[model samples]
Target: MKNTLKNKDISQTPFRRDVLKIFNSHKNAIPLSVIEQELSSYNRVTLYRTIKSFIEKNIIHEIVISGEESKYALSKENKDTPYQQHIHFKCRSCNILFCSELDKAITISLEKHKIERLDIQAFGICNKCNIS
Candidate 1:
């Protein structure tokens, strides 16, 4: 049940429940645009506000890709929550998301910056998605 219902601190936002619901269905990250499209009830302002809160609270982290759209996934390891931080990989062809091993995670910050949190996303074709 822990994985099912992630403890959320959303006192500041009204549409917070809707925003948290976004991560419940998918195993991978979804773009803000896509999430907006999926949850049509909340208006743009609410979505943006909720996203901002989530980012600030470390509930979600941004996924960076070269040509792909910006994506966001839950940061279970965030201080606000008990979830553990894990890296992700998105396939170009199949678009499937995989949770990479934390020990195997390649990103390592040598120096501490002003950044509050960091997550690494490596993009490429997975073994099954690879073309022969």
Candidate 2:
């Protein structure tokens, strides 16, 4: 986490390190409320600022699904394209949001139009939930 902060040119503070640890511990995207609950002693403003910094520095990316609060996931390093272009999955059963990569990349083309970013989201019962 310290190395990630350093690479992103962000100051490595104790609070920032703790925040990153929370992100690292989870596999799925997480909401601010979960972070607040985990670090109950910290002020809300401080946590918000830390999250903002992480987002600005591309250490994490926010996922906004309709009718739900935004969630954040750590950005993968050394990718050719922006991580947001990858598909996002939301489990209907578990209500967990996560990133999923497809076996083959999807491509779209349009004449006289430039496509910048693409967001694809799938909703279904994830494997774990399907098994239960």
Candidate 3:
């Protein structure tokens, strides 16, 4: 965690550390509501700014959802690099999203266009959901 903060040049303030902790504890992208619930003291504006800063620093990546609340997940690479190509699975039954790496390399070409990042999400039932 310290390495991540240092790499991003973010100060190790208590609030910032706590916010980063929340992200570290979860393997999936989470909504702001979850963070608010987990932390002791909640301030809407402060949380917003923290999240904004994290995003700008490439410490986290926003997950695009359809007709649902915004969610954020930790980036694959720490420093502003094109996020490692990976896949995110969103369980349709439980509404939980999990990230996983692809076993084989993927190549994409966009004629005359450059790609900064690639986000791929698949929706289905998670293991827990499938069991119950």
Candidate 4:
């Protein structure tokens, strides 16, 4: 976690570290409410600031699901690499958003334009939801 902060050129404050830890521990994208439940001691504003800083530093990225609250997850790609483009799967029943593996790096071309970043999400009932 400390390495991530250093790589992102962010100050390693206790609050910042704690927030980063929360993202590290979770496998799926997490929302503010879930983070609040885990970090009961910290207030909303502080958490918001920490999240905003992480976003600016590229330590994490936000996943937006329409009609639902925004969720955050760690940015695992290296700083030197081009913007990472992958897929996200959102479970309709449980409302959990998870990162998906890409068989190959996604690429796109538009005339003379080059695509640097992309955010794609697919929604359906998850395995757990299907089993239940």
The RMSD of every model to the true structure, in order and in angstroms, is 4.4, 2.4, 2.6, 2.5
What's the C-alpha lDDT at position 96 in model 1?
73
> Residue 110 lDDT in model 4?
85
Ranking by lDDT: 3, 2, 4, 1
On residues 17-131, what C-alpha lDDT tens digit does candidate 2 reach at each position? 8899899888889999898888848988898899998988888889999899999998774345554358889999989899877677777888989977677999999999999
> Lowest lDDT 10-mer window, candidate 4?
1-10
TM-score: which candidate is best? 2
lDDT of each: 0.69, 0.84, 0.84, 0.82
lDDT of 3 by residue, 65-121 (tens): 889898988887764564467888999988998778888757788999997766788
Per-residue CA lDDT of model 1 for 25-65, tens digit only, reads 67777888778877767678867877787888777777767
**TM-score list, all predictions:** 0.69, 0.87, 0.83, 0.82
Candidate 2 off by > 4 Å: 1-3, 78-84
Misplaced by over 4 Å in model 3 are 1-4, 80-82, 108-117
**What would the TM-score be for candidate 3 when compared with the true structure?**
0.83
Candidate 3 clashing pairs? none
State candidate 1's TM-score: 0.69
